[model samples]
Target: MNQYLLNGKLTAKPGHQEALAAILFQASKLVATAKGCRLYVIGKDKADSHSVYVTEIWDSKEDHDNSLKVEGVRELITQAMPLLDGPPAKGQELEIIGGTEI
Candidate 1:
């Protein structure tokens, strides 16, 4: 199957990286049981202290989009808004050709 992959970056306001990471971590929990969710890994950017990255894999792009409807997701998004340095940049969408089991 051709899986959907997204690499998203979020830049927190000064001193809010931990807070933003916390919110995203909470979101990871909320989506843990979401349909088609395979992997959702959070990472910190070594060069940019304010940046956090979320890498996700889903069965399909539709499944990824539908994840937004999962319970508490919207709320988490709302909670994350003010912590951002500015509007988030679009996530990088990747076409998965091959990979080891997730």
Candidate 2:
């Protein structure tokens, strides 16, 4: 099995902090339970409400691809549409073998 990760940075629309947080909260929940998902989280940038981070883990590239077809995943993306200041960027990743604790 291969694990896949996505790291996204988001910036909210002007004066839309609350809206962005609300959507992020709901979308986190939606993504956490999506098929093939191992983990999903939304995090603040520590500098501004407009800046945020989203990290996700999937069981495999195929699983990640399949999850885009899930209803919850679709809804989460749709919910996020109005809150973003720019298009999100994502990366596929592999973990470094020695970078974890037992």
* Candidate 1 positional error at 47, Å: 1.6
Estimate the lDDT of model 2.
0.71
* Local accuracy of candidate 2 as per-residue lDDT tens digits, 14-51: 88766777777777675567767877777786678676
- What's the count of clashing pairs in each model shown? 0, 0
Shift of residue 9 alpha carbon in model 1, Å: 0.2
| Cα deviation of 51, candidate 1, in Å | 0.7
Mind giving the per-residue lDDT tens digits that candidate 1 earns over 1-102?
699999999999999999999999999998879999999989997889999999999999999999999989999999999999999999999978896976
User: Which portions of model 1 miss their true places by more than 4 Å?
Assistant: none
| After superposition, candidate 2 runs with Cα above 4 Å error | 95-102
TM-score, every prediction:
0.96, 0.74
Q: For this target, which candidate reaches the highest lDDT against the unseen true structure?
A: 1
Whole-model Cα lDDT per candidate? 0.94, 0.71
TM-score of the candidate numbered 2?
0.74
